[model samples]
Target: MSPLPTDAPILPLSQTVSAQRPGDAPALVAALERCRAEDGAFAYSAGREIGTFRIEARTLNELAQRLAGVTAVAAVALETGPIAIQPCWTPGRLAEAEHRLGSADGGTGDFAVVRLRIVPRRSGEGNIFETEFAGPPEIDALNAAVARGVARASAEGVEGEGRIIDTRVVFIDGAFHPKRSTPAGFEEAAIAAMRAACRTAGLRRLEPLMEIEIMAERDHVLPVVNDLATRGGSELRRRLAQKGVAIAAELPLRAFLTYEGDLAALTQARAKIIGEPQLARWAEVRRR
Candidate 1:
């Protein structure tokens, strides 16, 4: 996920899917489908896919506030109990709450940090949000940064080790010394650490992914087929399969800016972007 744009309004982004009660996504998905057939006016990317993340929080408001920073968090909603928070918040206050976001499932093994990334949603300002939680420096910095951002508007949060931490990186042990320059271990470590730092910094992952539908004239089918055959740099999860050939792909909001329009152009302007990508066993289930 990219950093929040300096000029654009922050859109809601997230990586917290489990935040919703079990089965909530499926129920919501079914409901949206019904609405589409009956109303035919569902906003594209409305039904967002949810990614599960852990955050340590005593109340929902604390979670919501920090989430507002990562650039991904949308309007915070309560999953199990009523969510209570102030209508408005500041960057400084959110920083202190950095450590508050822990996985509802796992609390980073006593480590105060977690790995995370911000994902943009389909609607609103398209700001980025947090995803996942790891440990150590990333978690530490994120926790500190969030408070700092919030402090820019509210209270002074705990200051983290301002300098970049090296432990933040991870190495995918290539079995036994093989090839390449350590496989970007430093970069990977930094990302994991950065994400953790974001979570700690108060950026909550809201599990926001985009759902795109492509429709093109019959004559344009050939190009569409060709693109589908060769489009490989990214991961595309096709959510719906229209036997008639109108293709639908559940694209991760994490990387849409790169080719969002390009994909549509290929469809001959006949594309119809649907709701947000919802989390599932398989992001998209398509038949050939």
Candidate 2:
């Protein structure tokens, strides 16, 4: 694949007011806050948590590098709309620039940032940010390409990969070849950048968990609840239904390894289990 130019800038998003046009500040901030707050649950899968943020700096490679140094961050992407900020920032450079430019003179350009944590899973506990971006048609296409690539790579998330497939990466900035820059090229770049960030930030294993509801005959309630307990599942709510007991629980995906068969054996295939995507949490890091 062709290499991204050395000078390709990855800018940090800023939440600043626009002097003329409605700076992407308000809508961007609203979107980011909403996403972060509501990022509590998802129906799909992808790598890592996704967030959007407003851009303040012109370039983010330095900032990303600094974040990678945090030892807990796994990866970071500052993007929304068609533009994306490649993983490249260094904290030292940003600090130096800030010191040199001073607060008032230091310009926080207009853009959005997306931060991804690699080590510790937030488990729907902490705040996840969000942002929005507007760019040319090419930018939109580039963002789509990045999404498609990441999704394809993460397709096995629910199939027992033990990873989330909901990695949200969008374009914040890049160099386009016009003739040479196809979605494939840009997609490779996006994935490469994220992987690079992960390497720098470190990776941790996290398992996708499911929020499940099970309905069974009255006679089977005790047995089913026992089964859940054995598999590390938690019974959240239980009520008597018209014909049986209704059970709500939280279960790790791994427990499903024999769940289908076990449920059949325990309830004689008469029990119903409803599964929905739930927040992911950190698990023991698997050693190679």
Candidate 3:
């Protein structure tokens, strides 16, 4: 199983199912039919006779629990999706973060002047890595070294809370002795400078928002709406349905994690809720 994209909208719960043996297709299909009968909300499409089957569910946990009893199934895997990370930065917050790393021979050291900033990119704009340093030393090696440094810092993170996501690391200025400059020295310097810059610039955490719809009886709708409000839901709209009322709203994913159980308890197991991740927005830092 994998986490879905934080910004994805209306992502249905999907899983891939495979049989244990080549001849188990018939058994697998029968077992899957049983699962589908038990929960009419999900549907599956046939694959190659011996290939995997794809299933989508409104409630994955319930479906998975039922699938666990299907002896013909060998494995079930959830479809993966994109992850989101937004780090806020400003020029005022960024300083020329500098670092010096001495050569192995103890010669004059390499000094790296790096400017790291979180220039927020439009969705899908990607990241930028630029170098303006001119050198007798190979520029490609220096660039590679700088890249390694940035990658290491990104993976390690500024304070270990979360890895640095999308950000720009520029080698705007630096000094490298022709004789003492080495890729290793420049790499170390870049890493140190990147971390220093991140610490100085600070970080802002953003959490994903989800669009959700809840179905509850007329008498239970008000209580459900109130509960959603307490969980930071917004833009609530309601409409009459044949069986009940449907309420639609946007809510932070964190607050919505336990909503299913809470909805059951609140409506005496008579309410149904489903959601899809929408966009992300700046939020107060909280542990996941």
Candidate 4:
């Protein structure tokens, strides 16, 4: 067969603000509190235990600069908005840059600035790619290409081979012209702009995340969960659903060694499973 095209569009995102190893917990908390006091929209997402909070910041840099001044900054956590990230799929040059960015010490030197380049997975194209690097910390002086690289490669996360397919980044660029561009046009143009840049950067698609939700009886939850763990899962979240005593776990979509029918028989039809694309960001699919 003939080779497919590798010219999919790429987008870059720069994290708004970041806080390096703040000194102590109380100080960091204070900085976060200060951020909350400001007025604006802030989006945050962390692990179930980590907990995410968003208040407001007129500008990301303003917030980061303030947070940086905090005493107990351990590792600067960059706001995931339009920041540069690095992963394996990144180009050798970008990879090297990431290394330099991460080499510095947080205390004496700049924060380890890593960049993850994310490439989209076009049909017959190839796998999505992401590259990581380390460097000094900053508010939002990140390059555009690097941010898109991270988003594309992270299209499906690191779990599913090609299941999860959405990693959108909200960027505030250009003006909303009535004849030139509308509000929606501005949004799409932002995505397209990044996508075009991705093509120029020469990055490709990487693995996506998956959600293999399993519905089973209460008694079978343990066994089902165990079986899922036996397989490779980059990140998994488990929760018991309403009725059916359903035990649903967001697992990698690539896991296909076990059969649902057999599992059903083993659990006497009390167990059922289903999987589908967890589309949150398709690099440039949805409207931001």
Candidate achieving the largest TM-score: 3
Alpha carbon lDDT of each predicted model: 0.32, 0.42, 0.58, 0.36
TM-score of each model, paired residue for residue:
0.23, 0.35, 0.54, 0.28
| Candidate 2: Cα lDDT at 133 | 31
Which residue ranges in model 1 land beyond 4 Å of their true spot? 1-211, 228-244, 252-255, 279-288
Question: Clashes in candidate 4: how many?
Answer: 71
Model 2 score (lDDT): 0.42
Candidate 2 per-residue lDDT, tens place, 1-288, comes to 111122122222222221122343344344434443553321111222233332223323433332222212212222323322112111111010000111223334222122222222234332111213336677666556555543333332222232232233323344443444466655555444444444454434444345678889988888888878777676788888786888987665566545767898888898977554343343332221
In the range 1-288, model 3's lDDT, one tens digit per residue, is 111112212223445566555576667777778866776544564433336665544344644664465543434332222221323222224445777665444545554444444343333333456677766647668767877776666654434323454455667777666566667877787888877776667654544456788888999987887777777676458888897988887666666667779889988999988555444432343432
Name the best candidate (by lDDT): 3
Per-model RMSD to reference: 19.2, 20.2, 11.7, 18.8
Clash count, candidate 2: 37
Is candidate 1 or 4 superior in TM-score?
A: 4
Q: Name the candidate, 2 or 4, with the larger TM-score value.
A: 2
Stretches of candidate 4 off by over 4 Å are: 1-206, 234-243, 256-259, 274-288
Model 4 poorest ten-residue lDDT run: 90-99
Positional deviation of residue 114's Cα in model 3 after best superposition, in angstroms = 3.6
lDDT (Cα, 0-100) at 163 in candidate 3:
41
